[model samples]
Target: MGCKSCGSGTNEDGTPKGCGSKGACNTSSCNQRSTYDWLSDLGIDDPYAASIVEVSFKNGASKDFYYAPSELEVFTGDNVAVETKNGYNVGRITLSGELVRLQMKKKKVREEKVTESIIRRANTRDMERLAEVRDMERSTLVKARAIARSNHSKMKITDVEFQGDGKKATIYYTCDERVDFRELVRQFSHQFRIKIEMRQIGPRQESARLGGIGSCGRELCCSTWLSDFSSVNTAAARYQNIAINQAKLSGQCGRLKCCLNYELDTYMEALEVFPKKADKLRTEAGLAILIKTDIFKGIMYYTYKENRGLLYPIPVAKVHEILAMNKAGDKPIDLQSNQLVVEEKDDVFGYEDVTGAIELPAEKRRKKRRKKKSGTNAKGRSSGSGRKPASGDSRAKTGEAKTSNTGDKPAAGGETKEGSRSSKRRRGRSNNRNKKRGENASAGPKASSGGGDKPANKPSTPKPTGEGGKGGSSSSGRKKRTPRRKKRGGDAPKGD
Candidate 1:
């Protein structure tokens, strides 16, 4: 018997060692139905002449009740030979003493019904024979499956177990429907030259016999200690608020996970207080649809039809009250108005709201400002505040006047002087308007430039000259006019 659970290798005498007890075999930790014989531990003498013992074969894959003869001294974890259908089979004693009676009652096996008796404590010869049979199981299983497939049997052969004496073999298989394996069994018997017994089991049983790790990262419960499997369905998942995903819900057995039923009763009891048909709550805002439920917290989440992503967590008692009101044909003002409000204290050092303070970098801000300025200019032009100059005739006339007046001045300072005088004129005009409107004089120039309406085009006024003559007066006026012409020409086509 190989203890796959503990990964304990076989001893030199061919018997499995330790039973995965981890030095706790005395505490009855090896088999699934472990029984700590406290009476034997207390040194209490046996009261019965013969006691029923539970012997497990194939590493607890199969177990049977055997009558222990008073003549043979046996204990739990001891290797013993037991009577089978044909010859004797060797197995480990899993249960002994008074606990054996309780285990038999649990399994519904009566004392008189268990006619099989332990033949003897396994000796060296028996251990060697058992090891030989165990070694032949793998090859026999492969050959049996091939024979079944060749015979066109609609069955999956999962495992094969040989008798200790090598005179018999048990073939375990799984099939969705009833399968007649009479011919298949006959082929196995002839090919292997042993008595063949075919056993049909469900997917869960097959997985238990062929044990492996489950999705929970542990050995399969059925293979370890779960001798009985309860019916598991989607209802268990629904009760526990688990998503209905086939791959997640189904276990290695291709059925709903058995663990689903573990907390199902608690979930059922918790949900009983919840209002029935309360999935949709009537409200003045709209029909509030139920999203999900938190059974432990006693909270149900609901969202209105018009508003999404805003879940209102209502207590179970309040939900029932609302449902009762709805039954009486009264609608609540809003779901939130009746919801349970859990006050959360603000953390002084927690993350502050930076939404309003957030600003773009300087380069990005400059770009945005330029974009706004261009858009405003476009709007101003469209609204008739500024019109495109059709031709350069107005510019030519002013340019000629400036050339004649500034002909004597040095070219270096003439442009700068002209620009300064134009700016002064603009400021003067804005200041005069601000005085008339009674507005702040300091803001006038900025207001004129920043406003959607551009400044009105006005003729430049000549500066007073020291030499009071007709030619001097005209030339001074011409100098002022030249700068305006240059400014107008700046907007002309590049070719000009």
Candidate 2:
């Protein structure tokens, strides 16, 4: 089959470029045409050399060219004149002589004989003169712009350069519309007293001339290795699947970066391994279009109606088989016999039965038996050995019943009542005795400590006898009379 990528192009050696990932140019030694080789082509004359150097021209113009011998003659610091169609351009001789051939070939420029020209040596005068030319150029730019403004012109004097000979100064400017700057140039020549040349340049060219490093962290291609610029567009980005962010896509030249075109073929190659998004496929239940792909995982998914229109996953190889069958105008064969099966992988469910047979659930477990109590049982509470209530008395009953039925003290005044009354009478007498004793006890201590109170009666009062008037006059005196004696004897006997 014809190679499945971009159609054939010429190789480096002038052979036909093929379709696969590899595209080589038969003309060059290391003959591949690729991003890396594009850079590699700039350094050496023989196309086989790996490293390449790039060059950029004034006005944001740049190109990739093979390094040749004529370009490598001068050393890094030595000033050398670069041969140009207009004139010999003086610059620090970066690469010279033979290196130019390699740089040129790297750019894929057809080899041409070098122009027989000698870029002359630099001297002290040349250095000083070049500096003077630059100072003059700067000053001239200001005057040039002023002149243009005075003339009601919109042109801006962007740069000025003093010719190597110091005989002429070139003024570089840019304008939206073509400007008649003849008067501006004449005025500048008169002011600086030198020959004046006016040159118009574009924005990219301006950015290239005043170069800066790019986001890629390298010297700008326009200033270094590119010689010509081609119009770059959004399509270059599209082909590489890059987003069209202007700032990112544009280079230091304020134009699309030339590097955008470098890896396009690689991305194109990668896409081949993936399924074409345009082709629609039919499954058992529904029709499905190829919506997306994941090439690395080798996974393809098909949407079908019955499965809630959700995509079902199948391996890429399986999809390829299905595609082949469809392409051959044949129905898909049953894949169960020929299907490639992945081994059972995980313990989504746990351990299998160890006895090699399924076990049944245990029959309803038996209920346990209880031991009965020997005596009267109480309601609500579990009984152990129970005690019976005593008859005629309620205190011996269960704690709750006894508490509820018993009034203050056993009975008020029945038999138990009479006992309570007697107890109360004894308590009353005892209480009175206690009260008297308390008063006597309290008074006795205070009286003894404080001395007893004096009595109301006289101190000499006579003591009374049991049967007589006074003890001193005794019963004998009273017995003087016989009656009195008998009465006394009888009284004495009675006393005994």
Candidate 3:
């Protein structure tokens, strides 16, 4: 028979070996508390040593001490049938030898009160009966819950367990108030044909019996190693400076998480040196109110009453000094008088603030457009006596003309050459205009009167006309010749 405690198979003598009460498993996987019998390993000093043993039932949910007869030779992990009030009960031996004494003392169980004795190692028939009883527990639990609900009972049935003999069943439940299930038990016994026992438990005990995963992504402490439940409240959360949100603080048991108490002692010890009545500090500007306390860093945050939004962190010692000064009828000039200076640590990669240093390629495009607007205005004034197109005027017509002449498939090299020539012409016109304007200014009224009229007509530059004529003639010829080639090809086909 395989031991249910550790799930290990039969030992060499065909007896089951459970997780020995050594507080550890032989395989090192089971975390259920087991005792290591160092006395057995070192050899028992007396062969007739007191054979008081600890046995666990229902996989350690319940445990009790049993007297083992010396002649039976029972060991840890041996499934044994023990005597109970009704008939007999079966459990796996978890501890033996000198270790059982220490375990009893830890649990405050007296050896003389342990009247139960192991009858014999569970035989094949006994093991089979235990398996049958174990299968009935689930269905029994569901039916018991329905019975309780149908009868309008306030109790919540959490779990059910049947004795190995299949003679009795224990129903575990939780409720806010006491429930008298006297009639409910009569109905359950009639339905299941067994002795019914109702055991009332707390919410935490119910959660432990019905195991579940906690928010920490591990098995619940109540279900795993934590056997005792301590009172957890919002005070533990306040000491740790945790938010008082109920949903965040609650655990699987719908109570404040037990983990909140784990680190509370450390927080309390660190907060001891902080001043208690330093909630408000007097300053020349205004009264600074306490915002928060950083126990680890020994800093206290305070904000001016006039400007509650702005907070300044002051060292614990400095805050005490300021408070002492205020108590003595003197106030500091400002809350910042004892401000804490936090040193900046250099990053491993030498991090830099490049928020302002980022330069987008699109910004260069915007600058190019602005420069083009200014240049075009200057060119228009110099060439055509300031008769320039409005800024909103569409340049699409000229752009379309270029696109049509180029057939939208112009070579990249050809486009670059054309662009360079146009730029050169604009530069040349600008320079010539500049020279004329300077000469007019130096030559006074005579030069202006004589040259102004001539320059006005000279606005019709040969460079633009020459370039326009070339593009127009080439486009017109290409359009005219394409139809003639199609006509010639059509005529040849008809003649053939």
Ten residues in sequence with the least summed lDDT for candidate 1: 370-379
Candidate 2 stretches with Cα past 4 Å from truth are: 1-77, 80-90, 101-120, 154-156, 175-177, 217-219, 274-279, 285-496
Residue 481 displacement (Å), model 2: 85
How well does candidate 1 score on lDDT at residue 288? 94
Put down candidate 1 lDDT per residue, 1-496, tens digits, no spaces: 4443244557665545643232113322255434444444444556773478888887788889898887887876778889888999988776777778878888788788988899998897998898888989999888887888888888999999989899988888999899877777777878999898888899999888887788889888888778788888898898898889999999898998899988888999998988778879888889999998999899999998777879999999989988988899998999878888888878667788897799766563333321211111111321111213234222221222232243433222122111233443444453444334443222222212221133433322233344553212233333211112223445642210
Total colliding residue pairs, candidate 1: 0
Clashes of each: 0, 60, 9
- Candidate 3: pairs in clash: 18-77, 21-34, 21-35, 21-94, 22-34, 22-35, 22-36, 23-34, 23-35
Candidate with better lDDT, 1 vs 2? 1
Each model's TM-score, in the order given?
Answer: 0.63, 0.44, 0.63
Q: Candidate 3 lDDT (Cα, whole model)?
A: 0.67
lDDT of 1 at 10: 72
lDDT of 3 by residue, 1-496 (tens): 4454456676675544533332223532233433445554443464556689888777666778999998998776677899999988888776787778778888898987999899998987997899899998989888888888999999989999889899989898889998888999899999999998889888888877787888889878777667578899899999888989999999888988988989999999998999989989998989899998888999899998888877899999998899899889998899766798778878667689897799656543343443222123232443312222345442221332133233334221122111233433443344344545442211111111111212221112111223244212132233211111123344542100
